[model samples]
Target: MSAAALPAKPARTPTTPSARLAWLDALRGIGALAVVAEHLLPWFLPGLRPYWFNLGIYGILVFFLVSGYIIPTSLERHGDVRAFWISRFFRLYPLYLAVIVVMLALAWWVPVREAVPRDGSSVAAHATMLLDVVSVGGVADTMWTLSYEMVFYLLVTALFLTRGHERSGLLSMVFAAAAVVVGLVSSGAVLAGGWPAYVSCAVFVVALAGVVLGRFRTAAACVLGLMAVVLLLMSSRVPWLGVAVLAVMFAGTAIHRWERGTGRLWPVAVTTALVAISPLWAIESGWWWVQADVWITTIVLAGATFAGGMALRGRRLPRVLVWFGLISYSLYLVHHPLLKYFVQISGDLRRAEVPYQLGMAALAVALILGVSALSYRYVERPMQALGRRVSRRYRGGLQRGGDTGVAGQGAGDHGVLGHEEGQVPDRVRDHVAQVDPLR
Candidate 1:
């Protein structure tokens, strides 16, 4: 769709930074609920779960789009690789490690899934947050998405360092085209097992040190980016799907570029079409959700939802959804494990009468929301604040030390929100901090 053909941004609504971000929160809230429902219905209300589209996939796609829209902007706004990575580390890790620890602590009572490799390799992959790409399973099923998020971040950092970030539109189509070719030639991961995880973890650590310490920063970023691509293409459990997910994310970036008048909408449109069909022949024994019609429906719906959010970006969104958005990251990570534990205590509700099952589902959701809100308050919020402080200190030190490299001041673009160069709004930056690794 052309920019002119899209829905007009409502002029009457004020474009305050918070107002601009509310729609993203709303989307995150909706995505989080959809994911929770997807997990819950199968165990608690299997009869009501719709087969028309995969709710989990829908939620994940929405999340990746949101991440794509905001993440690079966050890095650009900071204009410092050290600050950006520090912010990311604190924003994502504190809660992520907590969740993993909680799950492991409970493993004696509720064993970890057999899909997870019980080895040091799992630790290595999880430490890098590149679990899926390295062919190691995460402690939580939802965590596979984090691998892609990490890959995108690495690639974006490389693009930023090399001044190639503006070619998001072209990159989107490239990934999409690669997805199609990879699907045709390869159905499964070729570089499987523990070595990929160990090697990736080592590269991730050394490369991150090089980037942050301002020693061959661009080279470090390029190496990391190349490794991310290799892992996605040769080591991911589903190579085609991995590339396609990256395509969808870059398409989101293309849409942002189009909105900012830096890019045309045609690439986004073409990328969407390509990704929709990229998985048609991806695997020999694909699940029902990946069937052509169902998969296309899910992709189209996710695109429409993002488009809808963009259209309504200027308007005030409902508060409940905004609240959901605030607690969404915690909600996303916490729900599945809690659901599994609840099922253990309550037994399967799938055989129960509809009303009884629904009541139980509602109860579970309430508990999940309550816990998520607390985690947001006690965990995510504090860690994010700490990340910001650390980022500020690092940037301040860089300025004081006259380290005017890419990891120093005034190094990145005017970010996606159209802020003046080096003048990213505090409200927008804070809101962007809440970009869930997986909503």
Candidate 2:
């Protein structure tokens, strides 16, 4: 058989411009929107609520699944794990630090004491990406997931260092095994009365598994899904294990879809099931097993929705949603703190008044959007340009020395799967070339 006749293997492409992946972008926007709605519930909507913001929890799962799909692809593009980590640090840390600094300044200068609690534990946790690890409260409540992303990055880098990009199967197994070990260890610890350590370790393990195995071929997805189901059944008896299982399953399923390709009707079916049944299942089953089941369902459904939307016949996302996707990360990181500050300063405006709350919400959204745009333009873009320059220089140096794979020439552009569609442009490549002294 001709090579072209066989089923194509899944491979990470380098970053380049192509048609945008609207499904993933749309999913990100939806996740961010859900978060905004959940936060607004306390101030705006009352008595019409159902199930205590569980939808927000599901939104978080979508974020994780999307992360799993994208991060490894990013590592593969840069050709050097150390460089990838450096780039991630540049991209994530500046905004994070800026937010912290702003919050601290506001606390001291504005006479509002609310920013004080945002310091200490919350600040420490956010700084370290260990919010859940340290049990901090007021920092960025949504930052708990950033901790997971950090852990996943570390694990993927380790895998890349040891295995390069050749042995994806082996990498997937290692990831799965690590998760199992963590889950078992955490479960034992919980049974032994060290619940804090147990929860922390368990969370780390599950997230690790989610990122690693999530890139594996489709078969692993079934195994991960079944494991999640079993974990849900056992969660009432062992809550930590249950959560870990759900994470693993969600990652596995997302990876499977990413690898195998999404069919037209699949996402539609999955999203429908989740939107219609998940909440009701949670309501009926209560918090015990329901949390696990609902989360697992949410991830699967969100992934499907994204994939399906991307496969749509026409443009799947409006312009606004695509823009939101570009800046979603900044929005996610900045929104909570900004909202808290807004509420604190607007105390004289009658917090209970519907109009006041609505206005505050609108103002918060605008601030988040504006700040995110500015940050992307001034902060992230420059650093990304710098990283590309360094990478090209390093690659040129290797090429001059007659090194082949070191520069990852055969590797396509670094294609982070879930983000803006298409490969990195030639203009970016040439601009970086001009800046790269080594070249």
Identify the candidate with maximal TM-score. 1
Each candidate: RMSD to true structure? 6.7, 12.6
Model 2, 53-170: lDDT tens digits are 2455555655555565556555555544434544565566676676667766776643433212333444444554533333333244444455445545554555454454333333
Tell how far residue 95 is off in model 1, in angstroms. Answer: 0.7
Please report the TM-score between candidate 1 and the true structure: 0.90
lDDT of 1 by residue, 1-439 (tens): 1233345433454476678788888888877888888777777787877878878788778877888777776666666778777767776788889999999999999888776888889999999989878878788776777888899999999999888988888999999999988988886779976999999999999999999888888999999999999999999877888898898788778877777767878887788778878878765426677788888888777777877888888677899987877678788778888988888888867789888988998899899999999988999778877766666667767656544344433422221222111100010000111121221
- Candidate 2 yields a Cα-based lDDT of 0.45
- Candidate 2 least-lDDT 10 residues: 424-433
Displacement of the residue 379 alpha carbon in candidate 1, Å: 0.7
